[model samples]
Target: MSLTHDATLRELPTEHGVLRYHEAGDPGAPPLLLLHGSGPGVTGWRNFGANLPLFAEHFRCLVLEFPGFGVSDPTDQHPMVAALPAVGRFLDALGLEQVDVIGNSMGGVVSTRFALAQPDRIRRMVTVGGMGRAIFSPSPGEGLNLLMEFTEAPSRERLIEWLNSMVFDRALVTEQMIEERWAQATEPSTLAAARRMYSRAALEGMAKAASTSPEPPYWAMLHQVRARTLITWGRDDRVSPLDMALVPMRTIPDAELHVLPNCGHWAMIEQKSAWEAAVLAFLTRKD
Candidate 1:
């Protein structure tokens, strides 16, 4: 289910675990790495398939699967902490001196931490429907149970429900999108991973705790993000509300905000053209 298309998938060893990734565009082009969110059956392709070619036209694009998700080998280490070193290893393996990073949701969380720790490694960062900035305050929009929705009784209907919850306009959710996600969700191994995501004891504080506790303490040091940043959000997003974007807009010295109306958490999918254009303009700007 992961390689349903013609995209080339590759694997490499990282400090955290084996990493699987896909790359496209010219070798000489500036590199841009796309990181995905945490959701059942989420992979780089699922999150940014509609985006790769458009972005590749300007810059080399590399999309890496999270250490434990997609085809990448699962690790007992907390997936969150594991992600930091894993990304470092990925860059080392590729000999990329610096890259522009675009992250969504959980991956956006990772990018923020990565930028703070290794500011020189990232030229610019874009976060869409991101989390981890909620340390200041948690705004649970629409009050949906994201983790339980998948774990209770994983089904096409459930995935659709979760998908609909992310969007202001439910009709944008295409049937093909539903079927593809359903296929990945029904896959025996992916479903098992989905179960672990919500219930795994080792992943507490990383996933489970982050999901359950409204007051889950977070360290959103927005002041530390030195790279030019673009924060995008669907005004109707429930997982990470539009209010969450305001924190970065107000704090990050070089950050800009773009709120898409009638959009959902999956901007690249729901609002593909506008999302791509906004990102390209931000990454290419001289000043």
Candidate 2:
């Protein structure tokens, strides 16, 4: 399969486990990594196929499925904590010394965690509805249990309902999209991972606050980040909430915020054209 084709899956070995990722864009272009959200059915291609080529114009986009998520097995490290090493190993394997990263939702949290830990590894970051785990910010769903309820007993209607809740424009939640997500969610491997993740989260006390903020100095560290950051969000987002966007706006000195109207959590999908333009412009900015 072609780079643009996700049906042809590829795998790369990391210290923890093998990551199933999709490759796209100009092989010679600067490496740009795209991380998918933490939704139960998310996969690199599912999350990014629409916009991969847009970025591919200027980047060698490596869309990766986080360990324990798409086609990857659960690792010893809490799935959340493995983002750093996963990306590290990915880069190492590809001979990419450093690269720019763009993450949404949980992917954003992981990107934030990775950037704080190894600032030098990241050139720039774009977090859309980024659910950074910094404890200072608001918790997930503003303390709602809706996502869990949906996941516990998922169906085409429930998936559609979840998307309707997630995207500001109900019309954007199409039947095909709903069915596709439902199919991905019900896949035995993916479903198993979700169950395991739910269990692990409960054990780690993350079942409720998957978006819990990181530890001390993390706030300070966010302030210290030298890489230019772009924070984007749907103004009406309930999944991660719009208020948390303020944390990065105020904390990251070099960051800028762009909130889209009539949009919800999935800005990249709901507001793809605008989101892509904003992301490309920010990542390409030299100043």
lDDT on C-alpha atoms for all candidate structures:
0.75, 0.75
Quick one: best TM-score, which candidate?
Answer: 2
46-124 per-residue lDDT for model 1 (tens digits):
8887787778788888888876664687766556666777788899899998999999888888898888888899999
Candidate 1 ranges beyond 4 A from true positions:
1-4, 14-17, 132-144, 186-189, 192-196, 199-219
Which predicted model would earn the best lDDT?
1
Which lDDT tens digits does candidate 2 get at residues 162-220? 67777787887676777777777888666666655443345357533534655563445
Candidate 2, 250: how far from true, in Å? 0.7
Work out the TM-score per prediction: 0.85, 0.86
**Which ranges of candidate 2 are over 4 A from the true structure?**
1-3, 74-77, 132-138, 142-144, 196-204, 207-220
Model 2 TM-score on a 0 to 1 scale? 0.86
